[model samples]
Each structure stands twice: as C-alpha cells, then as structure tokens.
Target chain A: MHDEAVAHEFQYASASHQADTAVAGMWLFLATEVVFFGALFLSWIFARHFNQAGFDAGAERSELEIGTINTVILITGSLVYSLGVVLIEKGKTRAFIMCAAAAWLLGLAFMILKFAIEWRHDLDRHMFPGADFGITGDLAGGAKLFWSFYFFGTFVHGVHLAVGLGLVAWVILRVWQGAFSAAYLAPVLVVGLYWTFVDIVWLILYPLIYLIGRAT
Target chain B: MMRLLRGAFSGSLGTLAALFARLSPGKKEGIGWRVSGLLLTWAVMLILVGIQYGVSRLHFAPGLRPVLLVLSVIMAALAAIVFMEIGKGPGINRLFAVASLLWLLILLGLGSMDPFTRVMYYVHPS
Candidate 1:
C-alpha cells in the first residue's frame, strides 16, 4: 500500500479528505456535462416533436443492430470498469489490472464497432447532414435535420469515450507502476465515474436514436 | 427428438443456475463474482434493449413514448447508483451526486418548456 501521506499543495487536512474533495470536483464537472448534453437532448425532443414523421423515417433508416450491439458493449465495458475498481479496493492489484485491461479492450471494441463499422455504413448510405444527404421527398428537410442531430450526438459521445479510454490507459500504466493502492484509488474511481457517465449518455441516446420510430 | 430438446434446455438452465449461485452475494467475493456481476449487468442491458425493440414494434400511443424513455432513464440510474456507487460515499459526496442529478432535471425541464410551448414561426406565403 502507498504511504498515507497527503500530496503537497492540497488544502485538505487528510488524504481521505483530499480524495473526497477530488470526487466532489469531478461530480461538479459532470454536473456541467449533464447540462451540456441535456441541451442537445432537449433540442432533439423538440425536433422530433415537430417533425414526427420525418424523425421516424430517419430513425428507421438507422443501423439498429449495430447501435444495439454498441450499447451492450459500452455498458459491459462500464461494468468491467466497476469490477476493476472493486478489485483495486480489495488490494488485488493483479486482478484489478486484468479487469482494467478487459474494460479498455471493450472500450476499444465499442469505438471500432461505432466508427469503423457503423459510421462507414452510415456514410455509404449518405446519412451525413449536408448537400449530399440521401433522403428525398417532402420530409427530406426534417429528416436531414434529424440526421444532423444523430451525427453530432454520436460523434460527441465517441469523443468522450475516446477520452475515457485514454484515462483508462493512463490508470493502467499507473497501476503497473504501483502508484495506486487500496488507500488511494481515487483516480481509478473518478475515471470509472466518467466512463459510467458516458454509458449513461448512451443509454439515453439508444432509444432516442434507434428505438423510437422503428415500428412506423 | 423431444427428449433431446428437453435435455438441452435443462442443461442450459442448469448452467444459468450455477452461474447465479457463483454470483450470489454470500459467495466469496472474487473474480467469479465480479465476472458474474458484469454478465448480469449485460443481461439487464440486453433485456432493456429487447424492451425498447418490443415497445417500438407495438406502436403505442405517441404519449407513451415518454413513459418508455423514462424506463431507459431508470435503468441508467440504477447502473449509476449501483455500479458507479453514486450514493455509497460520504454524505457530502452523496449530496454532490444528488445535486448534480437535480440540476440536470432542472436544466432539462426548464429548457424544454420553451420548445414545448412556443408557437412555430412559419413564414406565410406572402
């Protein structure tokens, strides 16, 4: 276990106090992110409300199978990450590293499935929100807007996941160097929170993007 | 043929039962339990996806869409609270977590009111 010494420059009286403050800070940052993503969701809701048929058409054209698979992959990655945290908390470093590696691989798999497979498929279908967009007819404009939102939402989400994967890799390196211990797993826990937050965003996005308009 | 089918079904059930037993909370907390938990989470997510697909196929009343969306939010909240341990921390930490959620709700609620209520300004054919 690492020594219980608090890092210099922290105003907290104890290491645990410092950890608590750090987590609180992370939560505050996440709160801001919630509102950030919330604005996009609100816009989507309005767009769908006004352009129901168009949105439905756009959604029906989406690659539902891939989106569903990616959802499962991301959620499983989050679970693996939480398990890694559990192992770390138990002072089982080797098991923690294994779980972390598994989580990272899952994260990578999600990115590949989304960007390499799904986005390419979308591009082939001309789902991009521009002059080259493929949809035609009376609802073309509205469907174009819907596709715009879809591309923006998923692209931003992918970026966040990429950042999270980087964080996971950094944590793995730290674990390899024996920097983390049962007493100081704050970085791991905080990064896991971010990863899970990304998962939560996808959970919300899954239905909106893939499920809502399928039947029609 | 009937016996073979039944045997296969029972065999799958037995395997599932054994997996659940290994994941039981009272079982020794180790890699097995953790892996089981991960699988259980995956299963729940898959079930939710099934529900989403099934509901979409049902083509329920448009008003029901919000209800279905709420269900997904609840599932995500469960993962957040349980897997992320949002509430399993110091009181202040829990306060921050709860506050973040509360603020998000406020943002969504207030931000949505305008779009929900305001009339669209369509240009007349002048």
Candidate 2:
C-alpha cells in the first residue's frame, strides 16, 4: 500500500500528477513505436500495390486458420490483462493476480502456437524468402517480397510480445509484493498500455499478413 | 502429501472463483462498470475477427480489399481508445495519439509518391 505521507516522487506535486505523467510518458514511447511499425506497413503497401497478383498469391498461401486463432488468442489476452488492471484499481488484489496469471498464460500460448507450430510449419514448407522459397514462375519475385514482409513483420512483433510478457511478469511480481494499491498503480497502468499496444500491432498485422488477397 | 496436494488444488479453484466474481457484473459501482465495458470490448473485437475471417474466404474485387484493411484499423483504434483508456486520459495524451497517426500518414504519403508517379521515359533521337 502507498504511504499517504510520501505518496509521490519529489518531481511531482501529487501522486495523481505523477501517475498522469507516467502514463503520458508511455504514450510518448508508443508514438515512436507507431512510426517504427508504420514504415513496415508502408513497405507492404508499395509492394502490394505494384505486385498485386504475386502478393495475393503469397497471402493465399498463409495459414489462415492459425492466423485467425492467434488473433483471437492475442485479443483475448489483452482483455484479460485489462481486467487485471481494473481489478487492481478496485483493490481486489487476489483477483487481480489471478487475472494477470491467466493473461500471462494466454500470452504464452500465443507464443507457442506462433513460433513452435506456425513458424515451424512455415519453415517446413520453405516459406522463407530465399532460394528454397515455395512459390515460383513470373509471380515469384512479388511473392518473395510478401514472404519477406511476413517473416520480418511477425518476427519484430514477436519480439515485442516477448518484451510484453516480461513486463507482465514484472507487474505480477510487484503486485504480489503489495507494491500497488488503489492510490498508486502507475506501473500497472503503463504496462497495460504497452501490452495493449502490442495487441493493436497484431490486430493491424492480422489482415495484412493473412486476410488480404486470400480470396484471389 | 495428499493433504498438501488437496490444499493446493482447492486453493487454485478458490482463486478462479474469485476471479470470476470480480469479472462478473454486479451491483458494485466501479468494478461492475469496468468489467462490463471490458467484456463488451472483447466481444466486439471477437465479432470483428469473425467477420474479417469470413470476408477473406469469399472472393471480392481487388479494389474492395482496402475496406477490409480499414476494418482492421478500426479494431486497432478500438483497442487503443478503450483498453488503453486513452479517452479518459489527459489532454496531452490525446494530442500525442493524434500526432502519431498524423506522422504515419505523412510517412506513407510522401514515401509512396516517387514510385507511384515515376514514368519510364525515353529521350530519343531528337
């Protein structure tokens, strides 16, 4: 629990002010991340615009079933984590911990499904953008570009997910130590912001990677 | 040993029950509102996913693909605004959010102009 007397940092006027600043600071970091991912999206736009047939061909090759499942898992994890944050705010510490654990497990499941099953399956089919690439003929170059985007985009997003899992783990430990209360839970809020942003990235990537051109 | 195992098992069940209670909407003011809102967000996102996947399975005009992409952007926006509580945040935070999107637009716009506009030309025998 927060000590009422020394509730905030020396730099802040009040505990609430400090919390607001922390949340704002997290937003600033996410703004930079927006640009970072935006560049990749731009590349994809150019590639898809010029090479529609090949790009669609590559998109059709993606594992739609697994992609849809992962999307469900990730978005569900975001909700579970959000619930944990709300529960903590209401001073339901034990329930909050349970929610956090559930969210973490969901995140772990996503990773396992993504890297172990999906990626392994992709490699088996030689989806990597190299000599052994599965697609061929006149559309091969564009298809290769699409595969490049798929591998790079998912890899970068997976790294972010790994980082999010670490943050969730840290939050779980801190909350378990009784470091947060209704009065002081900025860390939880910041971590929640980051985790949800990760989910948002995946949400956008889902269609680009798996949905677009599948009907072709 | 059996007693210890049983205790742990029951304890796990108790924790799950408590979590369910916290998540269930109730007469409680703040907790109920928050839980219901989050659950609603989850349901909406799930429904959107269903629609998106179903749409992808049927053939559509290439020009219509952007519509599906726009739906995805909406999902991302919904998560940002609701789950992140950006709507309830301070004014400056909203500014930052808007600025990030504006920057992304600038990047896409200017970056694409060259390739999209380039015309292969020949300065021939003149």
Candidate 3:
C-alpha cells in the first residue's frame, strides 16, 4: 500500500495478477507487524539490560521444555501447511484439507500448551508480573520486567497464530468450493508465508525467553 | 546442577534447531537461508545468555562488563535479521528496511523519554 493509487490500479491479466498483488500486500503487512513486534523486543532489551540479574532469574524458571515442544510443534505445522500448498497445485483437495487441518490442530496444541500448561504453571509459581509476583531478588522489579515482556511477547505471538489458524480454515473452505487449482496456488503460498513468519517470531522468542541465563 | 543447566536450554533451542534444520532443504531457494538464520540466532542468543549468567556467577573482573554489554547488540541484530529476513530479496529488503527504521523510531522515542528528561534537568537545573 505504498501508493493509494498504485494499489487501486489493477493493471494486469488473469487472476494471477490479483494473486501476486495479494501476496505482495500480505508481505508488506507482515513487514509492518515485524516493526510492531520490534518495539516490544526493544523495550524488553532495555529493561532487561537495566535488570540483567533479575531478568536472568526470571528466565531461569520459565518452562523452556514446554515452549520448545510448542516450537517444534509449530514448525511441524508449517511443514504440513507447505505440503498442503504443494498438493493444492496437483489438485489434491482432500490432502490440502488434511494439511490445513494438521496445521490448525498443531496451532491448537500450541495454544493449549502456552495457556493451559505454561501460563497456569507460571501463575501457580507466582511468576505473573504485576500480579502475585513474589520475587525477592537483587533485580526484583526487573524480574517483573522480564515477565512483562515474556507474557506480552507470547500473547501477541499467540494472536498471530490465531489469525493464521483462521487463514488455514479459509483455505479449507475455498478448497471445498473448488476455488483453488493448479493455476491458482497464490492463496496457499501467501498464507504459508504468513504462518511461517509468525512461527519465525516464536523461534526467536523460544531462545530469548526460555533459554536465556542458561550456561556457556 | 548438570541436569538443571542442561535441561534449561535443551528444550527451546534444541527443539527449534532440530525442526528448522529439516526445513533447510526446500523447493524455495531462500527458505533454507531463512530457517538457518532463525536457527543461528537462537543458537547465538543461547550462547550470550550463557556468557552473561556465567559472568554473574563468577568473580570475573568488573571490566568484562563492556564486552558482555556489546553482546546484547549482537543478539538483538540476530533476532532482527532472522525475523525480518533481511537481504532476502529486492521486495523483502525494502520491507525490512522500512520496518526496522520505523521500529527504531518508536522504540527510541518511547524508551528515551526518561533519559531525555534528565538531559533537560542538567540544562535547566531546576
């Protein structure tokens, strides 16, 4: 959407042009999302710097195991989605739906792990920032800062995953209606790019939050 | 102690590395690069955290602080490059550039508010 007039201008032949436009626009939008998440990363970096010890302490207790499993699960989902894209080109709608379903199920698994397991565990452990955080360390307040970023980062990433799941369902619906074909695979590719980007963000978070403060 | 330390990082990076490594070979030429970039970032950040924690535990000279501090910038760059997929292509390059620039402005604008107040303090000396 760099130029309002440019976006409105449909100067191309066939639906492929529209598809490319959609792909380009989605990519540009993801670029904006990156900038948005970048702000959170900055705030966390600054705050964590000021309170490294506290942040390290907070990082120590985080459920890296659970988070790592979720990371792998999401990656598996991305691969399934990719396979679905490939199958769509060959006109395999049933397989396409299966791949989309796998991605959606994996996403649900991730949410369950993040919310039901990890978040609840943190709450029970009194690790929730600004809520019953009973941290008594050199960087006590900074510990809260760590949790603040941790929770917010994971929460926003989860929202992206939710939207990605929506896209997966949309793909399934379009497949059911025979809306996609070998000639029209842009939608699947576009959503894969988006879902993978979301997964990419979590990839960074997996290490930063859960693995920080480990050993050399 | 062994299990605690090993168990700590074994989950996130270990898992991501394994999964991402398989995706390195794909029909897309740049996908491997993207996955590698993401994996490398997580690996490096894990190292940096280890260094920081180890320093805090030991009686390392206070002077090592400067080196450790510089490491944070490196870690941040890794995260940015991986997430932004910088240098991926002409199309993505422009996107990453604008996105990072915009992020920098917003972050510094909000982050420096407190320090800027201190700068005004010395100038006005109220």
Candidate 4:
C-alpha cells in the first residue's frame, strides 16, 4: 500500500480526512446536478401534460429497440466500472485496469449506438423538430415539442456521457502511473460517483423518453 | 451487590457486540462477500430494467406510468446506496445525497402548482 501520507494534502488533518472531504465535495456537485436535470424533467412534465396525445404519438415513433439496447450497454458499463472499484479496493491494479478498459469500451459502444446509428435513423425519419419534421395533422405541434425534448434531452445526456468517458480515460492513465492505491483511492471513487450519476440520469430519462405513453 | 450488577451489565454488552460483529458485513466478512454482494445488486438492477421494458410494452392504463417512475426511483436508490456507498459514508454525505432529492421534490411540487391550478389560457378566435 502506498503511504497515505504521501498522497495527503496539507489542509487535511489526515489522509483519510482528505479523502472524506473529496467524497463530500463530489456529493455536493452531484446534488447541484440533480437540480439541473430536475429542471429539464419539470419542463418535460409540463409539455407532456398539455400535449398528451401528441407526446404519446411522438414516443411511439421512437426507436425502442435501439433505446433498450443502449440502456443495457450503459447499465453494463456501470457494473463493469463498479467491479473495477471493488478490484482497486483490493489493490488489484491490473485487474482494475482491465475492468476500467472494458467499461470504457462499453461506454463507447453506447455512444456509437446513440449517435452514429440511432441519430442517423432519427434524422432519416424526420424526427428532428424543424421544417422537415415528418409528423403532421392536429398532433403536429405536440409531436414537435416531444421531438424537441427528445433531441435536447438526449444530446445533453450524451454530452455528460462523453465527459464521463474522458474522465475514465484520465483515470486509467493515472492508475497506470501508480497514482492510486488501496490506501488512496479517492479519485477513483469520486469518478465512479460521476459515472454512475450519468447512468442514473439515463435511468430517469428512459421512462420519460421511450417508455411512457408507449402503450397508447 | 453493586459489583455483581456491573459484571452482568458488562457481560451483556460484550454479548451484544459479538452478535453485531457476526451479523455486520465488516472486515471479517472478507472481500469476496463484498464483491458478490455488489454483483448481486447489479444483477437485480438489470432484472428490474428488463421488467420495466416489458411492462411498458403491454396495454396498461396510463395511470400505471407512475409505477414505472417508482421502479426507476428504486433503481436509482439501489445505485446510490450500493454503488456509491451513500449510506456507509459520513452522515453529512448522506444528508447531501438526500437533500438533492428533497430540493427536487420541492421544485417540482411548487413549480407545477401554478400551471396545474391556473385557468387554462386559450386565445379567442378574434
């Protein structure tokens, strides 16, 4: 184990204290993020409430199969990253690196499915909310609103995932450089928190975007 | 008599501690126990996802939408508690975690009050 004192910051009383502070800070940031995404969710509720039929029609038009597959990919990525956390806690650096690499690749797959494949399909279907939008009739207004939310929500979410991917890559580099050990795993733990937060956001988004109003 | 009472009390305390030590997932539980426990949580979450997807496909009442939301909340709680170790963290950390959700509830509840309660505005065909 690396000496806790070596990684210890001067401000904290002990290495453990510093680690605790780091985690608490991450939680604080995540709290703000909850409210940030909460605003988006609130807007979605209002839009759907006013335009129920239109929203349902728009939701039905969504690519459910691709959405489900991506959901699985993201969830599996989280699980892999979590296993890496456990491995690192045991000081199994090599095994942890392997898990992280696998998780990172899963994240990449999620992005490709979402952007390269799904977005292309959406564009071809005229799902983009604009002059070229395909949906018409009395429900056009609401369906347009629904697509607006879909594109905006997923795009914002994709940005967050992209950021997470970069963080994971950085973590892998740092871990390879021997910056982390069982005694000093705060960075890894906080990054895991961020990654999982992204996943949780997707969980909340899944029902709102793809599942809700599907039956109708 | 006082000495005998003290000894009995101490003995009971020791017994309670021993029970806790056995029951808790402490260092004695070993790494394998922790690893498997985490994997179990992951498995259950995936199963819940499958259930959510399947239920959405059926022709259920729209009111059942809340059930899906509830399931998602449960999954989020699991991830927060297990993957993030929110409960095992410091009390202040748990407070931070809960506070976000609380604030969101307040935001949603109050934010919707105006739109939900106010008379519907429609432009007259002038």
Q: Whose TM-score is greatest here?
A: 2
Which window of ten consecutive residues has the lowest lDDT sum in model 1 chain A? A1-10
Off by over 4 Å in 4: A1-5, B1-28, B121-126
Model 3 ranges with Cα > 4 A deviation: A1-11, B1-126
TM-score of each: 0.86, 0.89, 0.66, 0.89
What global local distance difference test value does model 2 have?
0.84
Question: Where does model 2 sit among the CAPRI classes?
Answer: acceptable
- How many clashes in each candidate? 0, 0, 0, 0
Error of 2 at B84 (Å): 0.6
Task: Quote the true-contact fraction of every model.
Answer: 0.54, 0.80, 0.06, 0.58
Expressed as tens digits, the lDDT of each residue in B7-124 for candidate 1 is 5335534654574465457555665575565556656765776677567767666645666687688778778776777776677766766777787788778877877898988898
Residue-level lDDT for A7 in candidate 4: 61
DockQ, each predicted model: 0.38, 0.41, 0.12, 0.24
User: Per-residue lDDT for A1-216 in model 2, tens only?
Assistant: 344644787888777888889999999999999999999999998998888899888888898877887887788788888888887887878877888888888789889989999999998998898898999999898899899999999999999999999999998898889887666789999999999999999998999999987866
DockQ, Cα level, model 3: 0.12
- Residue pairs of candidate 4 with colliding backbone atoms: none
Which residue pairs show backbone clashes in model 2?
none
How should the candidates be ordered by lDDT, best one leading?
Answer: 2, 4, 1, 3
* TM-scores for chain A over all candidates: 0.95, 0.96, 0.91, 0.97
Greater lDDT among 1 and 2 belongs to 2
Candidate 1 local lDDT, A56-108, one digit each (tens)? 78888898877876776677678767877876787878777887898899789
